[model samples]
Target: MNALAPNLIAFGRVLRRAGLPVGPAEALGAAEALGHVPFSDREAFRAALRATMVHRRDHFEVFDAAFDLFWRNPDLPIRPPDPDEQPPDTFPAATRRASEAMLGASQPRSSAGEPERRQDAALTVSDNELLQSLDFEAMSAEQLSEAKREIRRLVLPLSERPTRRFRSDTTGPRIDLRATLRGSMRLGGEIASIARRRQITRPPPLVLLCDVSGSMARYAQILLHFMHAVANDRARVHSFVFGTRLTNITRALRNRDPEVAFQAVSHILPDWSGGTRIGEALDRFNRLWARRVLGQGAVVLLITDGLDRSGAEGLSEAAERLSHSCRRLIWLNPLLRFAGFQPRAAGIRALLPHVHEHRQVHNLNSLRALVATLSADGRSHRRSA
Candidate 1:
């Protein structure tokens, strides 16, 4: 038996506790692989252990975390974090707690104000990265709660559009003759620098049409929270929920408290978690609220699973009209999360041709990607498609 066999076994057990499936057989294999590699080469040792132990790509991060936790600086005593420092934001409750415990264990109370500190940047960094990559459907209750917190902090920075209004600017292309003369009055009516005016720019209005039907319940529920967060964070975010009927929840989501806002939404929307009527819902929107909210170059986010109870009747015409009304029509479908997903449904097929962009929105990562897509252009405005 190798002298380090016991240590390798212990490490494998630690990995199992950390959510990786490392058994005794895998531990034995890892120990054997390590024996062939130079023990002095840390990278070689890690690679050998990883190849034998980790079965999935997602397992790599957990294994790396475990390896770092167990093998880190044997000579140096662990130092606990200072009492004043706030705990870092991390995800997947288990990993977060473990990191905080480890960091806190590294130090003991000291009489001096200055406590020795060593930054565990990698652990904190990897924890967040891992959390983002995790599927929302696979998250535990605790992880889901954590993910919600991250979503609350999320921002939707949409591209700005030029307004008919103008603001006085020193570097503007158009000279303001009236303001220039007014400024010159201070210097004996001689124009020192030309006063200029530029067209005012503001973010395009964001209109979200979310599906809250039976097939889209989970994703739609999370997205409601997301929309509420965005609505409260910024102006011009119009939110609506649709099932068999269209219900505008823009005013409902305006409250400072999310729970209160959600309750308000529930009171207003009666057909949630029911059958979907995407075409009829879009038809209602076009007839009643389209001109009201879709003005000022709005970007429409049509969120749904595209499962229509009406078999997509008038879906194409309604979809095309909605697409034409909005600056950019993005269809965010949770169904797109599947690898082999196809637009086989009548509603999906009917709506696909009209949308400017079709993307997934099943998790925080996808939501973040939505923000990225909207904010891709640094310019204030891009011509609407």
Candidate 2:
């Protein structure tokens, strides 16, 4: 066995503890890479670590945290310097001050006795990326709370472009030629009255169906904020949460502030994190709210992993009904981020046939993709089903 294999195993175990799924194969790969790395140079070591460790976006987060904690050096008491030992170099005063600012600590007074002012470049360079090693499922209560904040900041705002339609008024370029000809008969060829067209602008309605089952609890809080933004701004937005039951929380999310809206939703939703019944929930939505909310050009976002505990019959019935009513039915499954994912489950197979678009919603990058999907022209939208 190689000497570095043990150290690599230790690192992999640390990552596993930090909520990553690093296995023995990944550890062995890291160990093998160590043989090619020039550990004498700090930059070379860092480069090798980066190249050998991260396999996926999610892995990057855990690897970063383990690297920081594993490499951090605690201050030691002053002693007589050994000839063979290399002394730690003094970090620049500016760098030290910047580090203090990044930690939200008070900076020490300068040599002139005045407090050091923060510079934008200094602050930007000093800021260490926090979410790089954070696993959403493994974060502590405080870390989770901070993660939520970061998620909110990273969420790309959806662009609401007014879709053009054939309108009869006084300004539109798409001429109502049939109407114009009908009016021409009244003037007996002596006068021609041009029919005018005017465009009516209305923001597209956003209909979000969130899965609030036990499996989805990890993502519910953060995704609720994105739903809130859509609900509050768009006049015809509808929001619903489903587990064993379907609960409409459009009014709750319409509150001006997201915190207040989430609180209201929590009060209203009885099954926030319970057993999943995708079919029954869909059935209720189809029977009760379909016609009311699915009119005009409404886009439906179905947020779930298609894990139907209520059987495929119910899920299919509901999904088929919902798909027919809406202009587009987009299925957002976080499980697509996995390398070897397939719609092999009965629930997923049933639900997949009804969804117009199958999209991922696992991380920041995925969330940004969702914003792009929403803003994209409906005409250009692809249908997988």
Report per-prediction Cα RMSD to one decimal.
17.9, 17.3
lDDT of 1: 0.78
lDDT of each: 0.78, 0.66
lDDT of 2 by residue, 133-170 (tens): 43344344344445555555653333444566557877
True-structure lDDT of candidate 2: 0.66
Task: Give me candidate 1's TM-score against the actual structure.
Answer: 0.63
Worst 10 residues of 1 by lDDT: 376-385
Off by over 4 Å in 2: 1-135, 138-170, 174-195, 380-385
* Winning candidate number (TM-score): 1
lDDT of 1 at 35: 72
Q: Which candidate leads the pack in lDDT?
A: 1
Q: What are the models' TM-scores?
A: 0.63, 0.59
Model 1: per-residue lDDT, tens digit, 50-148? 999876433454567656766775335444355467443324333443344344444567778787889867646575777787766555434656787
Which pairs of residues collide in model 2? 61-132, 61-133, 169-196, 169-197, 170-196, 170-197, 171-197, 172-197
